[model samples]
Target: MQSLSNRLQTQPDASTATALLQLQAQVDGDPSPAPSSDLDGMSLGGLKRKRCRGDFEVCALGGEVGRDVVERGLVTGEEAALYFGTFFQGCDKYVPVFDPSYDTFDSIRRRSSMLFDTIITIGCRAENGAVSSQYQALSNTTKSPIAEVLLGTTLPSIETIQALLINACYSEKGWMLTSMAVRMALDLELPDAYTQLCEIMLQGSDNVERERDLFRKARVWFGTFVLEHILSLDCGKRPGVRADGVAMRRCRVLLGSSARTTLDFRLLAQVEVCELLSSGDAGADVLLALAHDRLSPRVGVALSDRELGEIVQGTRIDLSIWLSDWITLVETAGATEEEKASLVVNLKIQRDWSEMTMLCKGLQGIGIDNVAIMSEEQRNLIRLAKISAQRHMSTIMSNTGLYLGGFRYGMDFVWAKCAFSVLLLLKLTRLLPESSNMPQLIADSKVLLAELSKVRGLNNIYFRILSLSVEKCERALKEDLAQAANPQNSGTQLNFPDAEMEFQSYVPKEFILEWSFPGLTFCWIPFDFQDLLMDFGSGL
Candidate 1:
């Protein structure tokens, strides 16, 4: 009887070995043994085993696994712990989705490879040489998996959406990743997740684990929504996710619960700010209509210059109201002093950027030649843009030590907006050279851009392009100054034949082109000057 029992055990082991051989053969594309009933019985729960040989083959060819556990080989446990700590310390506050107290490196890595790799990639921004090297290595290793997720080959999950949002903040593929993330968030029905959580709470459910999971999904959706609007403003496009009042209210209700933390307050503040920016008054509606007209050129009734001026005035009032409300919220937000300070500076930059964007929109189709004939409204808009740009640069400069030093705790779009403010100052200087303070503002902006370009983590392609443009603007400004100081340098006289000719020839096309970075949409530039801003430094 003992011998018989041993034989039966050996039979099961032999059948399992045969099944393993069959799976290996399938993966290797080799002929395998014929089907056997024993293999069927060996299947888990009597279900047919699913084959994932192709996935393994793809990963093998790409030299990295395409699953959550894939990081086990590429990132050591120690490295992952270090990255997780670094990311939570510096980067997570801005996004404020992950809870460092609750989520561990192993838990996140086991949940989603994309999120884990993204966190590591952003964490690698540290100044240490070892961390920098690891960043490059981790970035390379994660690219294939990220591409696979983006391509929809992998299943969509809340973690993947969060990863895409985080990636959008820093990666060059921001717009693309954000669009994908929005689509995925919708696909996963994330917005409704908040409502469901609310319902669950109303039912007095005591399932803490389920409540936590739903809360996480809700947070991810909110993060994605807020980021979409921010990026849309940055890219001069409309946001994909519309603000839902019901969802926002539910989120607020959750915020008042025991689970609320300081990061939740920051997230709520961002959501409210974005919503206010997107919700404009009558003046904003008119500007939007004009933008639409510019894009399509339909023969619609045009508003008089005076009417446009009224719109600008209304828009400025709306901005003031928004700022007042924001200030009130910041004062009463109940966050720590450090957190409140960081939030204020970051939001102030964004607020100034929104104003500049609106003002620039008003200047669309009005070129250098039309400056003299511009109505008071047009000139007022230019003045507002100039002031906004100055304030934007000043805000950035004031916080230079905070933003540029350490881990550089702001989004890529924030820096892009800062660079755009510099370009706007240059553009405004070109438009109104007689403004007494314009030269000093332009010079200060140039110095700021130079400093930004020198920062290791903040030096991106947008900053590099801005740096080049500012350099050229400085040279042009110096030449103009030199000409003003000594007018008898054998060149043409100071007086011009006509305003049109002088305006056309004031800044050579080369200098304007030097200011442009092709395919880069940092902020709104006038449609007429698009060609002037073509990529002049292609070789560079």
Candidate 2:
């Protein structure tokens, strides 16, 4: 009988070939297989395995066939190119760590098939329905590999981290994926890449390619850090990555370097915004801590109305300053008029969002026990929150094109922010007297939510929640208007038997548990709408 190695080398299947390669590498005292000049006579799946081992030519020739055979899917070279172009053009702007000029489809595919598939999935999902129909199959193909990497069954690389971060923007398990990405990034010591790159710069190394590679790794770490904060804010959880002043300084220096692009500047600006929003001094942070205590058995001291006011005012001032500084930088950064407009719009929206967050925190801090005789400061905070919600919703409504066009391509947090604005407006409408423009605002918000819901690849939970919430709010507002118009009916309460049943039917319990509303914790229970609405009015 022939030896095991001889049998494997003579007629190797994909699994046996991989095992043989690993054994050979172990014998050679190297963990990775070395490049071999001799080509193995293997089938398509085995060819895919060889391609994964750095045979670029094999991948270039049989890439589609190998993927079709292994993943049970097919993406022709032309389709791959189109999807790659789509991702870099639309989606890559938000996640700017990946450089299209440097990482072409062929190059990325050669580096990691998982990353390649992730890019294609996102790109496909960003397209119109006709094109996006392929998204599900492609996305399905990526799940197994991603799970393997996440479970430690497959070793992770920087490419895996990038794939996870990008997919997290669209995945239902976004928070989990983001947490894993941060952990993998730390394990890879990506945070230290910047220091090493700086050392090389100081040493006067003339290796441009080496410097570029280090910059990419540094960008990846920053991307992970930024994503961690964004997802944390969305879920009302503390970020996995702590605030690092030295890391921020390093990021600033990197952005100021000649190699920095407009995208890098935008990412740095996001880092700064997240930093300010998550600061201990920020009202959002205070509220998050309070929320934790509320959910726990331990009783915590509530902030005085005066203290809450100060926090809100201080947060507003900080947000204003931050916005002003970034606006100036954005204008002077040599970006085009369109880019400037988009940046300014985003900044103003964030400013409004932060203000609303602070005001909501203030509202929550003011206990409902004394709703009838609320403090003047508390009333003022409610007024400010209402105005901020109005302004934020108005911005979203007016920039319908921007949000709708970019919704599929941007981060999931954008959808969360929009949902928060709608819910805030709903809460404030009940707390405060009905304004002349409240109906119009509600109508516009409905339209905005409807359009956003139509965006491809959007998480359906957001749409279902927002749609049902808006419907209930509108019905309640109409009832209030009717009661005021007729004194006899003023004492009569509106019943929502059908609405309640529909909401229960549409919104699953798991979705309620999974989807965290930023400031509207009460929204998790649709059945408690009456109580929550009364609670909002209780502090009025």
Highest lDDT scorer? 2
lDDT of 1 by residue, 1-540 (tens): 112112111112244334555645655777775354323322221123332343332222234444532345666667667766877776787577765545677787777666788887777654232236666776776566567664334446778787888878766647677777777766666666666777778888888778877777777877887776555545546555555232343344675545556677667656554444334332221123223233222256455667656766766676566556555666677788776677677556656765666666656534322455566777766777778777877887788766554335456555555555676666665666555475677667666765664555334555665665666666666666776788786265433323323323333232233222111121223443443345443532
- Model 2 residue 299 CA deviation (Å) reads 3.4
Clashes of each: 0, 0
Stretches of candidate 1 above 4 Å error?
A: 1-73, 126-133, 197-212, 244-255, 273-301, 365-370, 406-412, 433-439, 446-454, 457-459, 490-540
Model 1 local distance difference test score? 0.57
Instruction: State in Å the error of residue 426, model 1.
Output: 3.0
Q: What's model 2's overall lDDT?
A: 0.62
- lDDT tens digits, residue span 349-451, model 2: 7678767766665565454422335667777777787888888888878888775667766655565556657866766655565463767867887788768
Supply the TM-score for candidate 2.
Answer: 0.75
Report how far off residue 95 is in candidate 1 (Å): 3.5
lDDT of 2 at 335: 72
